[model samples]
Target: MLAASLAAGGFTADPAQLESPLGYFALYGDCTRLGNVLAALEQLWALRRHDINVKKHPAWYFTQRTADAALRLAERERLDPAEVRSIRVTMEPGGWIR
Candidate 1:
């Protein structure tokens, strides 16, 4: 729906529809309703703020630095593939998991 909306080339939209569950999810399954999707995106863009400051928390900072160090070590050492044994990665307790 969003891709179709972009192709239609219009900025106007029905606020009521844009706010509804059906509209937000494109559950109506109609090409004609794409205008509302485009309008919602436009409104989001217009309301966006550039002053936001994002700070990486301790766990994130450590995890990113660890990865960077690992990459640098690999490039500097140039270890042979056959000699490498095993690798393990550990993170802070609350870090992301999959």
Candidate 2:
């Protein structure tokens, strides 16, 4: 719901989303290590009619290879920069930390 609202331009993302390293990592992690987070994000993206600039709004979770990709997307899209979600053990070494 929150992610949708942000994408729709209805809500400004929390500055903390961008500022907090923990929050940043929490939302956008590797799907391989965090499949559930990725899946939920995919579903959220699918809910909206507009095209989410995958470049602008990144997967949030990124691998070493995708670090630059995430940064570029953050600069361009700035979507849900502060939105946080609860954890559901969707990934290993997990619990929710956002």
Candidate 3:
């Protein structure tokens, strides 16, 4: 419906195109497309304040928290970096990048 509206408004695009890697990145390339997307969202009443827990310094806060937790866990378990084989860090989808 959003795509249909956008197309009627002269901004034709396959909504599923954004699911592709290149199409996903293409979203950030055009201001017109971005504005059209916002407008479509507004028309569909899909735009809202979903992020209730806003942070002032998200990057710094998360990085510091992660470091602190890792250090505490390592100390508690007597983990030696030299003896450690691998370390895995998981992040929420889209959180791995900007």
Candidate 4:
């Protein structure tokens, strides 16, 4: 299930770590890891160029930014909602990018 959670956020997890939470903590402790992961996740959103960085904006603006980005990306990618298995719109709460 960890793999699937990572995939939902547009990340691929190591198979060897499938059963171990420690695999996560070790990678997470690296200073460069989060930025690298966020960069990878941005590729999944075709509308990234249009969306506001929610963290930089007011917290109340989050829902609108997320919904707009999802709609735009879905349209831009010519996505079929029925066939789409996963789409990530929200950042993890308190998950700082800086």
Per-candidate local distance difference test: 0.59, 0.50, 0.60, 0.60
lDDT of 3 by residue, 1-98 (tens): 66667878999667757544467536544424556556655653343442224344334444555666778899999999899897777655555453
**Over the stretch 1-98, how does candidate 2's per-residue lDDT look in tens digits?**
56776789866667666335566545554333345545656775553533444443333443323455555666787747576253222343432234
Model 2 scores what on Cα lDDT? 0.50
Give the winner by TM-score.
3
Clashing pairs for predicted structure model 3, backbone only: none
Question: In model 4, which range of ten residues has the least summed lDDT?
Answer: 52-61
Where in model 1 is the C-alpha error above 4 Å? 1-63
Task: For model 4, give the RMSD to the true fold.
Answer: 16.0
Order of all candidates by lDDT, from best down to worst? 3, 4, 1, 2
By TM-score, the better pick of 1 and 2 is: 1
Residue 55, model 3: lDDT of: 46
RMSD of 3: 15.0
lDDT comparison, 1 vs 4, better candidate = 4
On the 0 to 100 scale, the lDDT of residue 62 in model 3 is 46
Off by over 4 Å in 4: 1-61, 92-98
TM-score on alpha carbons, each prediction: 0.30, 0.20, 0.33, 0.30
